[model samples]
Target: MNTPGTLYLIPTVLADDTAAQVLPPQVAERVAALSYFLVENARTARRFIKSVAPQQVIEELSLTVIDKDSTEAQIQAALHPVAAGQDAGVLSEAGCPGIADPGAELARRAHQLGLRVVPLVGPSSLLLALMASGMNGQSFAFHGYLPIERPRRVAALKQLEKQAISQHQTQLFIETPYRNQQLLDDLLATLQPGTRLCVAASLTAPTEYVRTDTIAGWRKQGAPQLHKQPAVFLIGA
Candidate 1:
């Protein structure tokens, strides 16, 4: 007999209490209270937990960290207790817990066991950037991060761009913070001149920036100094 667990949705973004940003006060509070947390990246997740609760020493708590590389049976074994009656926090290295981050399967298991899932509100670079992209928001696709290889990545971008324009849909994606500049360079060199690009940087942070422009316009203004931080990108016809 285990205490039934609650699946809390935590986003890494910092924003107001909007539907788009549901990982702030609401989610963070529960995560801080939960006796156990199942995070994607233990090291990073520990750091974040500390940031949100300065007094809490996460390493001392009963937390389990899992990743895409983690074993399914191992993860399932941990959830056994939470699904019974304990509260568990599912988190990501950045952004939302289940978006682009691992934990989709764990969430399914929690649901099957009749656990209550609670989602918090906060920033989501994806929705925030797409809303400001001025692209066809009505029809859009989030293809996750593009390939790192030059040729394949460019070809993929071209194909997606073509499909978006032909179908009047906006193509959205993201990338590792450090490699963001490289991705931008590839887009600039490969995409057509008239294509529109939107970049949302440090969303909800003090130095947050949102810019939309054509490849030529961005090149002339020089690339933004994003450093190795999270950001979301959008491109359209």
Candidate 2:
């Protein structure tokens, strides 16, 4: 039996133009060494690889799609090369793979097959947002996305606020870019006026914005232009 090759959990830049500033040189080195990759989007993954290693031939790399809808058998097939001693990488559409991304399933399968799983350092919007939020970092919870419906979303926000106040924990969540403004509106309406709300948008980019203020303060300042920007929302005591 051949030694199983490693499965690298590669991280990508949070913003399109901040790759050089956010990703370390080691990320490029590791990506250049691998020929097989499982990515959420092949086009973006190819673009990211090209940005890091300009000399790399994109056509030579085998990019496989392992998205939210990927089945168990499909994931198993994607890992076949790694199990046969060919190193493979998993890339997310943005930030670190396996966090809120579908790459987690692949990593879980890799562990089940006894293959080595190594995570490469890179920018994660969630961590960056929390780091700058001035919230209770030691006790924080990340809820990937809130309910889409108005009633459910409002209920979820109220619950998150309750948790933050009772446990002194920072409750973090994200919304689809297009629905960012709607979520913010709901948050302001649902959370208590004294609760602290943080909206971190376009992190790691030149237009990055991070602000933490009480609900009343936010209302006074008016809603930010978060209509279609990548953002993270946090509720804290």
Candidate 2 global CA lDDT score: 0.94
Runs of candidate 2 with Cα error greater than 4 angstroms are: none
**Per-residue lDDT for 224 in model 1?**
84
Candidate 2 per-residue lDDT, tens place, 62-121, comes to 999999999999999999999999999999999999999999999999999999999999
- TM for candidate 1 is 0.86
Could you say which candidate leads in TM-score?
2
lDDT of 2 at 84: 97
Top lDDT hit: 2
What's the true lDDT of residue 57 in model 2?
93
Question: Worst ten-residue run, lDDT, model 1?
Answer: 15-24
- Per-residue C-alpha lDDT of model 1 across residues 15-125, encoded as one tens digit per residue: 422323344465556656876888877777777777676677766777787788878787788687787677778877666677666777778767776788776665567
